[model samples]
Target chain A: MPGVVVVGQVARDLVLVVDRVPEEGGSTDVRERQELLGGKGANQAVACRRLGAEVELLGVVGADRAGEDVLAQAAADGIGVGGVLRREGVPTALLVDVVGPPGVRRLLEDVAPAALLTAEDVRSRAGLLQDAGAVLVQLQQPGPAVVEALAAARGALVVADGAPADARTRRRVLDAADVVRADGSEAEALVGWAPRGVPETVRAARELLEQGPRVVALAAGDADVVAWADGHVVLPHLGEDPVDPTGAGDAFVGALAVALLRGEDPRTAAWWAAAVAAQVVGTAGGRPHLDPDRLRETVRRHRGA
Target chain B: MPGVVVVGQVARDLVLVVDRVPEEGGSTDVRERQELLGGKGANQAVACRRLGAEVELLGVVGADRAGEDVLAQAAADGIGVGGVLRREGVPTALLVDVVGPPGVRRLLEDVAPAALLTAEDVRSRAGLLQDAGAVLVQLQQPGPAVVEALAAARGALVVADGAPADARTRRRVLDAADVVRADGSEAEALVGWAPRGVPETVRAARELLEQGPRVVALAAGDADVVAWADGHVVLPHLGEDPVDPTGAGDAFVGALAVALLRGEDPRTAAWWAAAVAAQVVGTAGGRPHLDPDRLRETVRRHRGA
Candidate 1:
């Protein structure tokens, strides 16, 4: 199955659960701790795989234990790691997340080998994107590499996620992508103004659509607005209690790409993406366990309704 | 120079600095994060190496990346790791320390391959302990392994640190050790009563002397008391600010063993140990950066006084 090709960063996340933020010089006790796989690109690849699509992840990891472990996990999850580069003398990227009650989390990240990924590395794996049904790229990678990957995915439905990026890269991705997904803050950052509510968010999405993407999806906490050239639709959340929302945006992008590849209408694809994201927030870490049959049933029921 | 042989656990510590302990169901933000090398046995080994002892570490780490990194660090610090075992299919021990305030810290540990160490593993390295001037063993390892190491260090001055251990293991270690060190709570747990002040601590140390160890050292936060067969000595602190005291006790043990090996009287050895430990508390982690010349000068000055 020629499925989705994802290009982005991969990292190991050390999670600490604490009660409150300590004062500047004070320390706090950690209630629980864990080390898990995380990174925007890796999370999206895993999300695509869990959502019943074949996934190829293109990224760079250090030539260390963390890198080996991540590649092992990706292979175990049935995500192709052929494009994953192991750079010597650099440590794998590490994200230390302090998660507190009510799902509050602060992140400190170290992007080592990630900074080593170059345009040449992305170009080396461009062949994987050739026959892909969709090509998904996250902005966490180096700007030139991201641009190279997008340029290589010419015939596929190109989906882009608004991870933190340089202004030039953001504009280039917006111009190249067929579909662009961004959270409220990311949308505001791109458009240079904060959108207040649904109507403002729709206005912002329409403004972003003018940059070249056929569809622009802006996600608010409990609401999402998707705009195309003609009109826009607001979608509500699934109302499930969220355990963690770390990778929900990536989940939405992954699912949206799959739905679009299946030739679903843009509005239907948005709904499917919202449902996948809701399921992701109810699980620990970024990758959620997915049941494709259950997802198909939900989609069928929604269509009938 | 034949120096000390240290047998115990080695771990990677993930330190999350927070302000205070959050309520049971509350979450908190992390102010900072660091990854450092730690473990009582490993700490003492590094301490001894820093204080100018040729040190050998006998321990087991997983055959994974963490193990390789730890062994590389030990070698870099001039601690011989020839006796360190690399066990397959197990992960290296990891300690997650959530530190709040100066004196409050919570430790969550995964012992992993450290727990897989067998008594035979210690026995195999008996040759390294035969000509060593001193041997230090921590209670963090398997009971049988600790006992075996002590048995193998028959000719050396055997020093023991009371880490968490069962009653029987505690008794066995005390019986096999020439010098035993414990913090207030550790001493209280072993002797069945808490020592409130200096007098009571000395009294308790004497009582523990009857339990088979030739000398017993009890460390309070700012004061330390050491009791041997003939008498006891109370040592005062260095009157300097302490930054982190995580490995101070191990520092005392390492320096005490070195002093005793040099034929210092038990009381003088205790004073040298106190000076070494005071230096440790001024630094982060267990192993402090040491200047051998400075340490020798300090010992000479104390002896002259």
Candidate 2:
């Protein structure tokens, strides 16, 4: 499949499991420490690729050690990082994480704004995007630049992951997308509406419709996902105890993009997307792959293709 | 002179700065971190008695934090963290500081570790050793208890800093005279050690001396100190140009045990301890204090004392 092109931040996630949150002036011992390759763009790209989609990722990483690791990881997974620009001297971005009783505590959060694909980098990869069925963009990188690139990809069906957006960024990117998937919090932040039950979801969908995207998918965890574009569709989550919920949303967006590219209708795509998300949530470290055959089998078993 | 009683791990000096060391997986950024008050016992007790030798610390902060901050610091400054046990939980502590390039970095490193201390919460504080001017200890509480309460007074000095050691701790104490001080790290690790130079100076002196006191005196930063067989001596490090040697070894040990204890000798007292060290290295955290006031003052002024 032509699959989805994801453009956004690619950062290292420094995860540590600490015994307890250190007291105001005290110290606690760290039980385990791990460094994982993660970024909204990388996660989404991996998710889509695992769901049988050819994925291309565009982001910036420094010429540092972490950058090399990301490049090697992407190459091993068969995801294209050709559009990535290697900036001289700028260090790769890092997310210091403490995962324990208090969920995850993020320390030293920084986004290197210059990592977004330059006009030249995007121009060089224009032919690749032109044939792609869908273009997925996340706002972890510089927002304005990704929006501009999305606007440039005329033939691709544009899907914006509006998870990390504010009113301004939403206003700027919402109209440029064919399909927009956002978590409930994003929906609430954009339109000041909370979609709870079926009726409320429809109201929320209508509100999102006013934002100009043809299809708006609002994922509300176990509650339900309400998508109304051409018609109303209620996609409820199959309950699974997710080990860590990080990157599950990215999985949903990527899977949905893949399903839509394969000519499935929004209803069928959303159902498959939820199935993919359920698998993702059940694993640890935002792991997107559970077993390819198993995922497809689960989707077919649950959704009855 | 019934010189300062240094009761911590007397070891060699090892300085491994962050910039010089190799980071894991190769490249990493140098975050502007502090030159921490590393040894729990040494820092706490020394911080308590900075003005002159009047300080005493307790506990086992290991050959690591204990040796560097405790024993070396005590001998240099002449304070005593009485019966400061030396064990091995970690290695000899190294304050791996990423000292900022030259001009502006000094200010930030000053306040960072300036407040740390070590106290002995596990050990009992009962009797004073023979003629002890003041007793000192830390609760860098190590496993396999080596310190126990002394029963004889003989007009010996005693001071115990009850910092948190092991959680389910058995109380072992040394008692009878003088001051006690504890701070954050000691409260957590329940053990402390002298920093780099302190242990080395003490080792040199202990290597030289044939007979010594039962009491201990540990000094940190600029605090001068001395401990008696039961009674400690007092050395003075009354010098200047101390831009960021913040705690001056707490001003506790050197202030009370050495300077205030009138019965003690002033020659090798804790008062002259840090002074001699300042003469050698010109700063509190620099080197071990030794020699008489005339020589110390000469070098101190030369080093911009």
Candidate 3:
């Protein structure tokens, strides 16, 4: 099977749970902790692989031990490692999610310049990207790398997530991606205003569809709106007051790409993606535990509702 | 030279600095990050070694990569690692210090039960501790291990820091230690109440001296009091407001031990410790960077003030 290629950050995610944050100069115990393979790109790749896709992660990790650890974890998750680059003399990117009460978290992202995807790193994997069945480009990477991935993956289905860092990249993303997805704030950055409710989100999604993408999915307030040229569906968010929302968007996009790859209708794929993302909102950290059978059952139930 | 032995926690310290903590469901980039070997025992041992004393650390770390990393760091710092036991199948303790502007920090400590020193682990190093010139016991370890360390180091000049865990442990610590030191809250736990100022601290210090420790040092408000059987001196804390106080007490304890080992009088040694602690207050993490000549000059300036 020609694998799906995920182009973005590959990092170590450390999730620490504390009852309450201590005052300055005070100390508190971590009630729970999970150190795992994570990063938006890595998480999405994990989600894709979990849903039975042969996936390749095309991201940069440091040549350090943590870089090796995350790569080992990714391989254990059944993601291909051939496209992954280990940059020398740098530290792996680290995402620390310190979560407290529901929806309360402090995210400390240590993303060094060298840890980010470089244009050179992407070009090195041009053949792999070009040969992919589908390409998931996380806009968190540098503009050049994101554009390069889009250019290389012209032969495959292209899905872009998050707001482009600059206007040139944003224009290139809309022109190249088959589908584009963003959360509330990212939508504001992409389209000049955040879609707050059903009417605004649907309107914004249509405007984005006009830009060139065949479909656009956006998180607006408590609902997710998925719009194509003809129609749009605004689905209510599944998890109420999510415990943590770290990886929900990644899972949402992964599910969409996976569903489309399996030939599901765009509307059903969008609903399926929303359902899958709902599962992640309840868990800590961004890594998805995607069981296709369960997700299908959830989508069926959610559609009935 | 007979070495100074330190018994307590050995952890990987991850210090992250951000301009402001992100709200619930928000993200922020860490402006500065420092990952190093830290924990009270390790910090004090580093301090001792930096001050030109041979030092050995007696602690438990997981038989994991992080454990190896910290052990390697300790060795690089010129501290003996033979007594640093690697417990099987556990994770090295991790302390994440998230600092914002001056004096604001949120500490998350992930210290697994197996990573803490066991009585058996302490006893295995009995000969090394017994033959040491001095022993610094950080009270963060379990009562049994702390007691075992004290028992093993009966021939060494013993200094105990922090509040003993239980009443029985308190009694054992007082009886076994030659010197005792406690920060404000720890002092309150050691005694019934914390000392607030010079007079109250002096009275409290005198009271503690009767409990078997030859010298008692207590942090009281902005001042530190060091008292012996017949004499006591109150030194104003050198730093106006400490930027980070995670390792202040550890450095203080280390400086005291190093000074006493070099045949300094109790008052001058206390003054020296206070001066050294002032230097650490200006930095992040608990690791001390001690320079004897510079520290001596700072002590002279501090005493004159």
Candidate 4:
């Protein structure tokens, strides 16, 4: 099945559960620990695959144990790995998530391998990108690779998430993406002003639209607002208590990619994306356990609403 | 180089550096993170190999990516894996070390595959145990496997470290070992009384000697005291600042096993063990990088002292 292609970072996430943060020179006991597969691109790919979209991943993983583990997990999830590169003599990227109580998590990241991905790696997978129904890219990957990937997916629907750390990459992403999904903080960083409420978020999203994406979706507090040349739509909260919000944004982008590929209207697609985010935040880790039948049922229910 | 055979657990250690642990309902940020090879058995085996012993490991690792990584690390360190078992469907053991400032660390462990080790597995390698110069066992493994490994090492000098959590396994380990090593707290747990001073530690070591071991060494604060039927010896500290003391006890045990195989007297062997512990505590992680020549020079200097 031809599906959306995702290009970005892939990392091993170590989650440690602690009661509270200790002061300097003090120690706290870890209540629980788990190792999981994570990274923006990988999480979105897994989300798409779980929701029954034929998904392929384009990224680089080191020839280390963590890389091997990531590959094994991606394969188990049925995501296509034909575009994944295994680089030798490098360490795979890593993320350490220290979760305290509810909704409190501190992330420590090492993106060594992610930074090593080059434009050559993306250009080499030009065929895969062109064949994809839609291509999703997270700007957290190297700027050069993201640029090359965006160029390669010119013939396909390009959905971009995340603001690059630098102005050049941010402008490049805004210019290349058919759809851009950003949270309130990211929108502030990209558009130069923080959106306060739903009205302001739509205004901010329209400003982002001026930067070039055909559609701009900005996730504001308790609501998501999207703007395009035609008009704007405000999506209300799906009302699920999130176990973890780490992967919610990626889930939204992944589901949106699938919706657009299925020829849904932007308003309906944003609602579907919100549903996926709700399901994701209700689960542990970045990759939620998504059953395609249940997801379809939820979408059908939302359509009636 | 048919050297000491190490039988016990092998684990991947995820070390997280955090400020003081958070309180219940609180959160903290992690300062740093690392992944390293660990486990009582793996640490001791690596220590012996670094100290120039022809070391072989007898343990089980899951037939997963973590297991593959552990094997690669063991092979790179020149430790033998011929006796290592690859079990299907189980995860490799993992230890999460949440470290605060110096000497403040909390351990959260999962011994999944280690617990699956059985008596049958140990008996299968009886020939390797009997042919070894000495066999080192950590009671952290499954009780049945520990018992079988001890029985198989009857013809070789059996050095046992770590007290079993259960009374039955503790009795069995004490009965099977030629030399037993335990820290002051563990010695107290095994003997039913906490040793408060050097003299009490020696008395506790002698009580442990009466149980079955030919010699018992109890590591107390600042000194190590060993007791045997004839008499006892107190070894002074090598006087080094320990960077992390997580594996110092294992280093002492591994080095002492090597020394006994070389026919050194218990007093001299304990001194050598002290030197090894000093080197280990001065390094990071459980496995210290030891140069055989440097280790020998330090041992020689200790003897002269």
User: Which candidate should be chosen as best, given lDDT against the real structure?
Assistant: 3
Error of 1 at A50 (Å): 3.8
Off by over 4 Å in 2: A102-108, A116-124, A163-172, A188-198, A210-212, A221-224, A235-239, A292-305, B1-305
Residues A1-305 of candidate 4: C-alpha lDDT, one tens digit per residue: 35889998877877766676555323455565667778888889988887778988898889987788888888888988888898887777777666666556666666664435689998889999999889998876778888898888988889988766577778888888999887766776667778898888888888888889888888888788877888887876663575666778888899888887888888778878878887887765756676666666776776566
Instruction: Considering only chain B, report the TM-score of each candidate against the true chain B.
Output: 0.87, 0.38, 0.95, 0.89
Taken in order, the candidates have interface RMSDs of 7.6, 11.9, 1.5, 5.8
Question: In what order do the candidates fall by lDDT, top score first?
Answer: 3, 4, 1, 2
Clash number by candidate, in order = 12, 136, 0, 12
Predictions: Cα RMSD each: 5.0, 12.7, 1.7, 4.5
Best by TM-score: 3
Per-residue alpha-carbon lDDT of candidate 2 for residues B59-137, written as tens digits (9 for 90 to 100): 4445543255546656566555455455555433333222222211121111111122223322342332344454443
Relative to the real complex, the DockQ score for model 1 comes to 0.14
lDDT values of the candidates?
0.77, 0.53, 0.87, 0.79
lDDT of 4 by residue, B163-237 (tens): 676777788888889998887657766677788888888888888888899878888887888777898778776
**Candidate 2 residue-wise lDDT, A34-77, digit = tens:** 45677778888888888777888877888876788777788788
First chain TM-score in every candidate? 0.89, 0.84, 0.96, 0.90
Per-candidate TM equals: 0.79, 0.56, 0.97, 0.82
Native interface contacts retained, candidate 1: 0.00
lDDT of 3: 0.87
